[model samples]
Target: MVKYNLEPSESILIQSTGVCEGSGLMTAFTDELILTNMNIIHVSKGLFGNTKSVRKYPLNQVKIINGEAQASMGKSTNGIPNLQIYFTNGQLSFKFQSSAKKEIVKYVNGISKVLIGRESNLVANQFAIPGAEIVAETLKDTIGVFKGTLGIKSKGKAADEPVKATKKCIGCMSPLTGTKGQSIRCSYCDTDQIL
Candidate 1:
């Protein structure tokens, strides 16, 4: 596995056995194209065990703008597959001789997932229902006593408990007395905070 500059947890998502196109028409070179969570790594290994060139494109800096398979009647993996990527600082096109369009699309999407973090594709909006709240009496003393008797120092909660905050209706500014996150209906306003 050619990690290139990948972090310890990074793993290859896609790899293609293909030759890469050079700047000139007659220039082509064999390379292992690998896509990982952190980068796109292109490694060219020399005939012997010697000269090796590795080019890494960090996922944070690149975006896949286009990907398509060559419409060729020759063979499934014979024609060249293309993927166009726009680096935040620049742009480039990668042509693979031994790849297909769908494979390229899958790899492009993998890159996008790494860059954009997981997010829902569909769009939806829901508003919170109005509600009346009732905050309860302070329980810091009880909580402190409970923890001390158990000899427990719970994570995040300090040794000295903080005072509980009061709740109020945002719409009417009416003082509410209840526990945090509890759903309660405001009898005066007929508004409800649903679960």
Candidate 2:
């Protein structure tokens, strides 16, 4: 059995043993592939079984290619389907038992779902407007200042008195209430507000 450490939130989703075709001396060796929620672990044991090497690939960076068609094509020369996992730097091909085709397909589907969901979330977050609440508050405050300057009474408050100028804290961007040309310190971030 292969020994590996799983993370706190990681668990084995599926596993299978197959002959792995990797680069360099790691080629054509039978290794155990353990699929976890966060990563795919490849465990290869040395000839003596005393030495072993483990490699981990993040699930987000893994891509399953031509997995579904393997069932019909049987592309390998030995009449077996090869499960190809593509990474950013290289690729790994594994030849598993023909009976495990269903499990492999299921694994591919799960990976597809994860990748799609991750991509959508990234897009959503990337285009999201930052500091929207701050912008809205600033707009409201600007409108109030304009009203006070025009001597427009708001909510039964008298606008006859001079309105104190407001500036934003340099560090925290919080509104600072003070007179023009006065220096104030922000209570939130302790930043000096120079107006």
Candidate 3:
């Protein structure tokens, strides 16, 4: 088992003990997957392949995780399990053989449980947390504060009077926080203002 440097509240839910390899993009690396409440950690070697290192994927940013069987009909004894994890940055596909089917099932179940719990928490927090993003969007008409802070201002009866509060992100329709000279980038969908 590859030892992982866990964070303060991070606790291991499952660990892939034996031979398991992860391959994606231009990289084929062997690492033990450690699933925690907060992250999915890959314990492997660093740049020189000598020192041990870890790559962590936060649970919130994960798009999806899927596991499917790759077993053949004739080979009844031996089963294969392929696990795929999708994230905002990238995704990884892992093919596990030998005694991996059982281990992969364990990992899938553990991750499902954690994800369900997080979803419920998010739903509950939706009502509790104040919407700070909404308030920031409504400040377009009132630019005096920004002018004073940035030391830039125009004469009385300013020509531009577009309400920033009314401006919504083109992708997600969420409210946007825009500066006068700077282009607005949507925080929700990560869309850059490119014309």
TM-score of each candidate structure, all chains considered together: 0.45, 0.45, 0.43
The superposed Cα distance between candidate 2 and the true structure at residue 187, in angstroms, equals 73
Model 1 Cα lDDT, one tens digit per residue, 1-195: 344566798888888755453333543545667888787777876544232788887777763333321111112234444555667787555666554455556565666567655421211111112231222223655776798899988677552555444666665767766655567777668677632
State the displacement of the C-alpha of residue 68, model 1, in Å, after optimal TM-score superposition. Answer: 16
Q: After superposing candidate 2, which stretches have Cα over 4 Å from the reference?
A: 22-29, 47-51, 63-74, 77-79, 117-195
| Tens digits of per-residue lDDT for model 2, 1-195 | 586789999888777765454333335445677778788787876655543678898876764344321111123555455556667666666655445455455555555555554222322333359988789999989999999899976764554444578877789888889766677889999887667
Minimal lDDT window, size 10, model 1: 119-128
Q: Return the lDDT, model 2, position 172.
A: 83
Give the runs in model 1 whose Cα sits over 4 Å from its true position: 1-5, 21-24, 46-51, 63-80, 117-195
Model 3: per-residue Cα lDDT over 58-141, one tens digit each: 877666433311111111122334555657777655544446555555555566567654222222332354866566666754
Root-mean-square deviation per candidate? 17.5, 16.3, 20.9
Worst ten in a row by lDDT for model 3: 68-77
lDDT over C-alpha atoms for residue 25 of model 1: 50
Give me the displacement of residue 151 in model 1, in angstroms: 80
